[model samples]
Target: MSYCVGVDIGGTNTAIGLLDGERVAAKESIPTLAGEGPDSLFDRIAATVRGLLGRCGVPGDAITVGMGVPGFIDQEGGVALNSTNLRWRDVPVVARMRERLGVPVAIDNDVRMYVYGEALLGAGRGVRHVLGVTVGTGLAAALVSDGRLFYGGGSMAGELGHIPLESIPYRCGCGLTGCLETVASATGIARQARDLVERDGRASVLREWFPGEGMPGLTARDVSRAYDEGDAVAIEVLRRTGEQLGRGLAYAVTMYSPDVVLVGGGAAAAGERLLAPVREAMQRLLISDYWERISVVPAALGDEAGVIGSALYGRDAAAR
Candidate 1:
């Protein structure tokens, strides 16, 4: 039977899955080691794919590969134009992978793949218009309108993370000051928590984890754990982060008027802790008619959304 291979490449790891129709037949992950550059990374990825196919007793010729890469992508040319996370610049990803795997390859931005997966099989199932936002190491979003991925003129339509917020003083990796992701993403949340602990010298459980002077290894997960323990600082951190995220999303809602806004990614795992404020802030900013018509919820597919979406999209691309 023909199969599709989906690859979700992130800064820290790459997740790969084998899709047998609508169900994931097999899946695995590998350290991205992105610092070693795309060539080394793709080499490992290709090896992993071969191993998976061998173990699954599938022939190489029977599969088409799809990849969801973070950062800017030239989907038509299969080139990773620029990826701050992966530190890639104008890398011809399709040529490299196709040369190694000898299969048809398709690629797109990772968040777009994620939303596509949700739209087809997860929270967005049967929904006509879906807006998916991911809050993780960084933040991003994608839109599916009428069951189709909407790539605006530049294929950069849903880049909500980079929207500048005047109140946010932090500098973003994109070399911008006060981008929304600098405050609303996982990195943002941890930064905020650390700052609060350091600036105000608040007695927070977070201090236990980040006692030392320089930037601590504190993470959003750490903040979540602290929030669970009823740490005042952690609670305040999530509330502010969610409020910023919600305010950022309000702009998307006003423009897209989606039926639902699906939030996903690592920080989203906080569930209601983060979502409650997101809902509140978004509702407060939007008019009653728009706010009442839209629903904000967590993305149902968890980490598998990107892989599933990329694989299915590759399957379609291969057929075409």
Candidate 2:
């Protein structure tokens, strides 16, 4: 049986897997060491794939490879143009991989893979319209309209997080002010919590949780714990975050009227602590005619979405 390799490259870590159709035959991770540049990163990934195939008793000729990354991508050519986190600029991903692996390769945006995974096997299964929201080191969205992932003119469509929220003044990681991501991402949530804790001078459970630690050192999980313990500040911070997320979702739904919205990534781990508020805000923002029918669900694929989605994309691309 023909097989495919899927790699999800991130700023800090990379997930690599082999897929025999939809079943993952092997999976592993390695430090992206992105600071070391693309040559080293790709070399390590290629080595990992070779190792995984060997361990699984699969032949190199039997497999292909696919990757999902952040930032602008030249999907047709498989070139990654300027991913700030990975520090890549116009990297010829496909040519390099093809030279080493002797197989066809495909690449696309990370969240697009998430959407593809959902459309194929997760919450978006059988749905004609799906919107995937990933809240992690950054926020991104992918839209599947009429059962196909929409790649707008520049292939940069569905960047929901980069949408500007006029009301918010916070600077975003993209170096732009007032982007929705600034107020709606995991890091953003942590930032708000830290700011509130420092400004309120309220006896924070976090203060006791980490004595003498600098306020900026607090993370999203720390705030999550505070919320679990009923800290009013943390509660308010997430509440606002959900509201911001809801506003963004509302705009997306109004435009595309997606049948379902799937939330994924690390922040989605907060579960109800995060979804409840976002749902509430979405309810308020959504028009009465559309509110009841639309639904939001967490990603069912979990961490496996990246590899699975990338493999699926590879299959389709190779067929074409």
Candidate 3:
């Protein structure tokens, strides 16, 4: 059977998988070691792939490899222009992989790969027009329109997280103020919770969760738990974030008019706590005709989306 390998490199963890047709043949995940830098990280990925190939009895010539990584990537040239999370700049990822593995490689933005996974086998299966939104430490989005991923002229078309969010000024990692992610990401939600706790000075329920506290901090999971437990402050944070996400989606709906909007990533783990508010806000903000037409659903592929999508990308590259 023909086989392909997929790698999804994230800020904290890297997931690798092998695919045969539509089934996953093998899968593994490891720490990303962001502090170690790119060369070492790439070496580790190479070693891991070699090990997987050996264990699976897949010959190098029989499989292609694809990698999904964070940040803006020149997929055509196989170069990562800037990955703030990975602290990499102008890294020729695909070239290095090809030199090491002697196998064809495909590379693209991580979120785009997640969307592709949805398009092929998950939430967006059989859907022609889809918008995949990820709300993790950061927010990112991908557009699959008319059965094709739209990479804009500068290869930055699907930067949904960078969409300006009115006048709430705050510098983002991307060097912009008031970007959608400043309010909608997992980091953003925690920051919001911190701000609220500091401002109110009310005995926060989260204090109990932390026990011995240094500085007051709330993780996305903590906020989710607090929301579920009926903490007013946590509920408000998520509600506001959902509103921000809805506003961003409102613009995307106008521009792309996608039929389905798939939400994924860590913050999405809040589930209905996040989605209900987002949907409510979307209904309130969007034009009635459009709001009624679009369906926003959580991504079904979960953590495997990126790896599966990367393998699919490799399959496409091999075909080409």
Name the best candidate (by TM-score): 2
Report the C-alpha lDDT of model 3 over 1-320, residue by residue, as the tens digit: 37989999988999999888888888889899989988788888888888888888888778899899898899999999999889999999998988888889989999889899888889989888999999988888889876568898978887788887775566897788899998899988887777677656645676677554443556888989988888888889899899889888888888888889999998899998889889998888888888998899999988899999999988887787
Off by over 4 Å in 1: none
Number of colliding residue pairs in model 1: 0
lDDT of the candidates, in the order given: 0.91, 0.85, 0.86
Question: What lDDT tens digits, residue by residue, belong to model 1 across residues 155-262?
Answer: 878889999988899998889999999999898998899888988788898788777884478899999999999999999999999898999999889998999999
In candidate 2, which residue ranges exceed 4 Å CA deviation? 211-214
TM-scores, all candidates, are: 0.94, 0.95, 0.93
For candidate 1, what's the RMSD?
1.8
Residue pairs in collision within model 1: none
Query: What TM value does model 1 have?
Result: 0.94
Inter-residue clash pairs, candidate 3: none
Model 2: pairs clashing at backbone N, Cα or C within 3 Å: none
Candidate 1 Cα lDDT to native: 0.91
Deviation in Å, model 1, residue 86 alpha carbon: 2.6
Error of 2 at 78 (Å): 1.0
**Clash totals for all candidate models:** 0, 0, 0
